[model samples]
Target: GTYRAFVDQLPRLDALGVTAIELLPVHQTDPQEGSYWGYMPLCFGAVHAQYAAGDDPAAELAALVAAAHELDIEVWLDVVVNHTTEVDAAGPTYHLRGLDDAMYRRRGDGSYIETTGCGNDVDADHPAAQDLVVWSLDRLADLGVDGFRFDLAAVLSRSPSMMSRLEAWARTRDVRTIAEAWDAAGGYQVGRTWPGTGWMQWNDRFRNDVRSFLRADDGSAALMEQRVQGSPDLFDAPGDSINYLSCHDGFTLYDVFAYDAKHNGANGHGNRDGADDNRSWNCGWEGDDGAPDTVLALRRRQLRNAWCLLAMSHGVPMVAAGDEHGRTQGGNNNAYNQDNATSWIDYARRDEFADLEHFVTGLLALRARHAVLTQPEWWGDALTFLDRRGVDGSTAGPSIGWSVGDLCVLANAWWHPTEFALPPGSWTMAVDTNQADLLDPPTPVDASAYVVGPRSAVILTR
Candidate 1:
């Protein structure tokens, strides 16, 4: 039934120019536990019967993929190999827990490892666990998914060789693997690790840097330079970093500017379950409603700013569902346990923010038309830090510039207008975030000086 619900959205999703659908885990969950986000897998081989469209869960999932493929959409599964539904002594003996205690790493005193921060983490270092992971992945591909996004992916690298071998096998089957590359425990290997592992990682550095930059924080220009260039410092390989500013974990793109902090009072954990350190900003008022008209408009402008940066950056980009248009979690940052409207994609909001939706589709089209943007190679050259003529250059100001060949993307995160010092050539405005389309795009600047609007970004082509 749930598979039918997902399939029903394909016509809309495909129209929105979405390339892939990365589903949260649909694997079998512990019958006793109340995990709403489906990360607690009890059996890796079985599909969650709850989402079954018919009597058969696997067939239902395959049908879902088959329908997506009909629209040329790739399907990605968020696979959890880190741990199981079984927590500790209080947990029941599911499939893996019942089979062998060796699969679960234990302390000298016999407490199960909690690296995933999910209570009971599996030990992939052991041979049996490694084999199980490989088999689970193979099983998922057989069920018709195009790729796997490994949850807390660095945990699988507890045995680097084992994870590598698994990736090699996946590549052979033409399946893509994206890793979270960091775990709740000590594994924080972002760009330094996972090279040559046949995997891409969710670039949190990219996310945070972009968030800080758009929030008009200090020293964001230097950070944006590294991020827009595909995070070369962390990922040396092409398409190895998933550059995203919003994901399922935190605030929606709309809320990134609409709420200064997470308003998770609805989560019922005393608003204490989610991260306190969300690098976000409220345009003026918390949440969307009742803000001054100018403040509300600024929220939309900031979203466009974020989207413009996301579209132009090198590497695969991911957006949380419902972000194309404004979607707020009513300020709930951590909605893992939210199974209701709080977490569901609101199509109604999609209609309300139609202009933002149009901007996103147009941005993706602009990216597709330009090859340099997709293939952003890092090389040492004369990169310019731009500001208006006659204005003193301030390193901490919310202004940044990146150029490749004749094309330059000038962004002003500053709340006021700033002039960009263009190269000595006539230029065409490839994209102006304030504009609706790029074809008969904004007028070409005939001078070496162009003023970027407050809280907006512009792409100029010579």
Candidate 2:
């Protein structure tokens, strides 16, 4: 019934101009663990029975997929293959653990080898685990789902050859493959970590780099440059890096600026459940309830800045489901346990921050309309950054150059205003985060240089 509720909103998602819908794990969960988020899967062959509007879970899920396809909206499942709800030896033996403990990872002493930080990790290195995962993919593919984003995908990397074979299976069937690409323990494959054949990974590099750069951390300019250029060091290909600023695991884009520290006490884990280094700046206050208007406006602009940077980056950009409309998780970074309004997108905020929605719309429209932004590879020397000074150009400057069709985006993270040198041309301002809406019109800046506002971003189209 809950998933059928999502089917009713396919048009809403399509209207946002996003291409794919990433659903959290939908597989059945054992009741003993109370896995609200569905990451703790009980069986790979079935959809969770509770989510079905009808008696047949498979049929209900298939109808949802069919509805999404009618709207040309690709549905992607965030499936977990790393571990199960049958957590540890003491946990439960309802499914996988009961079927065969050897099917799951274990040390020689018969203790669980916990790579997932979820106590029990599925033994993906074995052929049986590979067959189960492949079978699940085929089942969903036959049901008409478009793609899958693997949770704790780095576990697949443990058996890289098996990972490649599974990826190959998806490709043969024409299903798009993506991965979380890391485990909680030690797998940080932000870019090109696994062979990743026929696959893309969630770009943690893009997320952290953009946050730190926007907050004006030390040496952030170069970091910003690398990300804007698509992080070629870690990724050998373009779309291989899923450029993003926020996701389900951390603060929403709005909350990233609305809260300086995580307030995850409601998670009942002593406020230590979520990330400690959020790289967030709350403008002036710790929470959103009572911030000054100036602070609020700055926060809004910063949200737009993050959005614009994501749009401008070379990789395939991924925005959290509600980030475009300024969704706040009430400072609950680890809201995996939150199933109420705290986790749901507040429709009221969508209109309250309608300016943000408009800006994001224009940004996505702009990205879709530009070839440089949508290129399958970095523009290389074609795109160049110009270090800026004050309006009079007195401060130190970095090399400023650009190709004829490239988009030159300037970001002023300094506390004060910074000036930039734009090559004299028929350049139109494609984006300015400082504007009321991101794109009011194509303002012609026929000057050789211009001053950028403090803590703001500008995009120039030549």
Candidate 3:
């Protein structure tokens, strides 16, 4: 049932320029409250029977994979190997609990060590658990799936040796593995967690810093610089980060700028459900409003700013679904349970949505065109940061206190306009996130300076 639906939807998504469909946990989950994000997994070996067609679950999955492959789209599975749905005695029974309780989960003093905050954490240190995890991955790999987005991956590496072993096992496979490496403490020490070269982590630092800059926080400029260049403070190597402005969790990008405080009353939490430190700004208005042209202009510019930052950042860019159309959850940042219009992508708002889609497509294409932007190698010929002199220099060579190479990015986080003189050469104006008229046409004179609108970003290339 679910697989067939996905198979039918694959072509449409491809047409919309989606090359990957990251499926929420597909493993067997509790049947009653089963479809809630798939984080509450019950069986690691078996596919969720409800998603399968009739009794032939394997066949259904195989067919789905074949269809996606035919469209040249890759299927990425969301795996939750860190924990299981076996919460209490009332929870559903699965392979791990049935086979051997001790082999499946971690226990201390005869009590389950609940590191995942989801009742129980898998005993990754256990040899049996390791075997089960590795076997499950190998099974998916054999089925022609592309990669895995490991949910709560930090919990899987509670024991350092276990993380190392898992990384070693992952490297053997011909697929990509992305880790949700965030722990509860907000410490993004990727250097300590990542096992080796093959893993890429969700860069929370980038998300926070970029959001802070958009809100015009003090010292945000410095933080934004760190994020755009890939936080060397958090990550040890380059290209090991997945830069995202918004994701399935927390406030949508539109909501981030549309609301200063979360309105999560819909989640039955009386607005106390989600995070309070959202780092968002409402741009002088709270929630939704059919305001004047100025308000709409500001909102549009903010959206472009977030998109450009995500695309230009030094990492794998993850664009949350519906972000292109400025989707909002009506200020419900934590709409994990409210799976109504709050979570689904709104196909309405066609005009605004189309513009956003076009902007993102062009942004992605621009990034792809520049090898320095996406290359695994650090500080390649494609990226650069220019100082005032370099920005105003007559020649293209390196100027005082500037990182020069290919593309030059200018960001003006201040409320007032800022101007930068262009290097004396034919430099194409790549993007103006503020949607300002100054960015129109003729690629301003080589020696002439370009004005950046307040709270905006601009990309230039020679």
| Top lDDT hit | 1
lDDT (Cα, 0-100) at 390 in candidate 2: 66
The segments of candidate 1 whose C-alpha lies over 4 angstroms from its true place after superposition are 376-396, 435-439
Superposed model 2: Cα runs more than 4 Å off: 392-406
lDDT of 1 by residue, 160-200 (tens): 67777876888788988888888887788787666436777
- Compute the lDDT of residue 75 as modeled in candidate 3: 83
Question: Which candidate order results from sorting by TM-score in descending order?
Answer: 2, 1, 3
Model 1 pairs whose backbones collide? 191-234
Tens digits of per-residue lDDT for model 3 on 89-118?
Answer: 455666567777786454556676666656
TM-score of 2: 0.95
Per-model TM-score, in order, reads: 0.94, 0.95, 0.87
Shift of residue 304 alpha carbon in model 1, Å: 0.5
lDDT of each model, Cα atoms only? 0.81, 0.80, 0.71
Worst 10 residues of 1 by lDDT: 387-396
CA lDDT of 151 in candidate 1?
91
Q: Is candidate 1 or candidate 2 better by TM-score?
A: 2
